[model samples]
Target: MHRTAVVPCATPPRATRRLALALAPCAVTTAPRAWAARETASTMTPGTIRKQIFNDARGRATTYPPWMLGEWTCATTFVDASFPRRDVDARALARVPDTPGFRALSVARVPDVGREGTIEHRVRFVRVDGKTREDVGFNLMEIIDAYVGADAVEAVTTDGDDRTTIRLKPRASPNAERIELFTNARESGVEGDAFYVRESFRQVSLGYGTEYGNARVAPTDYEHRWTYTPLPDVPGGAVDETNVNKVHVKLVTAAYVQGQDALRLTASSNPRGAPVPKLGDAAGLAFEPVIVYTHVSLLERVGCVP
Candidate 1:
């Protein structure tokens, strides 16, 4: 299908992002040998892999390859007996049970066409690694400048092996985006196979409603993220090609908004004493949050890579 972004001073509708997430019963999916081969290539040293273990060290963030086609199966969720539930932000877990997660398949395709106009693609929610559940339509990400950045989230299950863990140090210029995340190696870890997607957005426009907040518009800038950690079957296991993993369609509707009279809080700023820089009331006009409703999915390759 053909999609074009030809005009300036205007924004396109954001794609319904489905960072493939799923919840399957305790059924193990043995990622083929290709998974193992790729993991071997990224180790910090020979015969040693820097996987998540009971340790504390921050690895330098490297400009690693983002998950493109030919390297990943669809995101699949099995019973993650080893998820890092303690690391997740408390605000994200409120009103939801602590034992919940979305381990699903996500599909992301970005053309290597360089920094030209804009990049566009769709994320679909499918079931059993086979059929389509819903085609959450494509979203648009317009470029802010010619400066594109890079980052990666690597999670490889050890196939229940006692893999040695290496200390990771923080790296400079870790991501292409202006935002740096999970910089410390201690902030990085892995578990069962599940892909959680997050988009970095830049606010474009704004308006005001009768609400206490601001009126929300589509984003002017955004980036795609597809991260999953899965166990690799090292000594090899029976490839149950027939056991299908079930799919669950999750409706992700969140708001991205422009700030109002809100002040930017920092390490030294305190409302009671030290000064804090605040945004404008803009003629007593406040805005509401931009409601973005997207979906996430989990799927596997129709055929494992050989």
Candidate 2:
């Protein structure tokens, strides 16, 4: 689960310094009355509660307690990727042998447009070798639009070269949530060969009880699965066949103890289910086939006060 890599000799240029600073922790504030009102109303039905939670412009329902608003180490492992038509095996896709460095930085509230709210997160991903080769710039997650009680949040990532957009929405079943993320990129410096990637994920949660020493479903035991697809262009620019390359699924659980100030989170994955074939080579290296399962756990502090 752990491996080490040599640090790159050179540091990032000054122009990129702003990005490094933005990756630091940030603080956000929310309207108290709005949050309290949502919590009170959510006690009715999980379905209605979820709708209300996402509908709230102030993001009151999704806000965590103050103690839960700090930096936490995050560990992610590769799961299976599936291809729809081809005979490709999902396990054969190359794996990034080294464990990617993950840091879930600042978690806080931000100004909302109209009635919708926003939460800013400074998430940084670095290569375990201590190199800045693979890094993400300042990313923003905001509830941009809502209609008839349905809400949508756009996650924008400016990676210097291109922009990646991730759209999150509530699933048909109240217990399941879907996150659709995609981007258009060039294939081989060709203008017409635009490649698109899409991922759909679902989340579920279980709760628990205290004082009486009994176990119940907590408010945050959620399971999510994301499927990745690649679309290629054909002649005439007409719609062509869609190739599904990978499917990543995970189940996460969170619990709060009677006297503890943090919520404990644990996540697991199912990597042996299916396989995805590899596409043509890129960046010089031939894809290294791999199939992996991962488990991650963390304790996040939570409090009523900011």
Candidate 3:
């Protein structure tokens, strides 16, 4: 009689560790052109145009030439303490300022961190006018943590740490057609770091251009997801359920700059989320959120002339 031996099915030791790392918490990571109508040049100065653009926090005016219309993509970048360490170039995205079609961009803490130190937020706008091009505007917001170097800053992952929420109000006008919004969130953490950070974004669009000013409005939707976890070499021993974590939402804007291009400049805001309880099961870490709102326009004109 002969007997046969069965080999046991088992994951390689290294493979098991790799799988664990793959399941660790992490981070997250558009646009275009065209034209339509033409309008007579108005004697309106840039100041007047800016004022008109800023009039309604929830609306936009048509300072763009009649030829400016169709679709445009907007781009923006944000930076926070939780961002992974990387080369900081002077020409980096977050270092740039805001521009036109890029209105109402901001950054802030949830509960107001008091005035400890400052965090920089930027926005920029660009447009085409005939063969010439112009950057409509630029701006920046330096958000300071009120508490500064306090324990709250160090234990940002701890529950009840200072947090903030930032908001942007679009400028409205009679000739304006529509508005849309989008955002991105990124974060990093070690395995035993005690807490995790997360982010959330929202936008609201209003319709304009043609039709009755009070006609029913159409809406759009946008959202993002990311996860963070400790690197094998991270010192804290790896995050577990016993630790506390924080979630932060960094908001960036994408708007349509009707006319020569389908996309406009991008804007950003820094908004942190409340602290979240950590869980020991690293395999179950996940990041997902629902987009609050989006708006689409029906105007047939370009935002800039070019």
Q: Lowest lDDT 10-mer window, candidate 2?
A: 102-111
Against the true structure, candidate 1 reaches a TM-score of 0.23
By summed lDDT, which 10 consecutive residues of candidate 3 come out lowest? Answer: 28-37
**Candidate 3 lDDT, 26-108, residue by residue in tens:** 21110111101111112311111110111112222113221222222222122211111121111221222221112221111
RMSD of each: 18.4, 24.8, 27.8
Q: After superposition, how far is residue 40 of candidate 1 from its true place, in Å?
A: 22
TM-score of 2: 0.18
**In candidate 1, which residue ranges exceed 4 Å CA deviation?**
1-198, 203-226, 229-256, 261-295, 300-306
Please provide, for model 1 over 30-94, each residue's C-alpha lDDT reduced to its tens digit, 9 standing for 90 to 100. 12111111132123221121122122432322221122122122322211211122222223222
**Order by lDDT, highest first:** 1, 3, 2
Q: Of the pair 1 and 3, which is ahead by TM-score? A: 1
Score every model by TM-score: 0.23, 0.18, 0.20
- Can you tell me which runs of candidate 2 are displaced by over 4 Å? 1-67, 75-293, 299-306
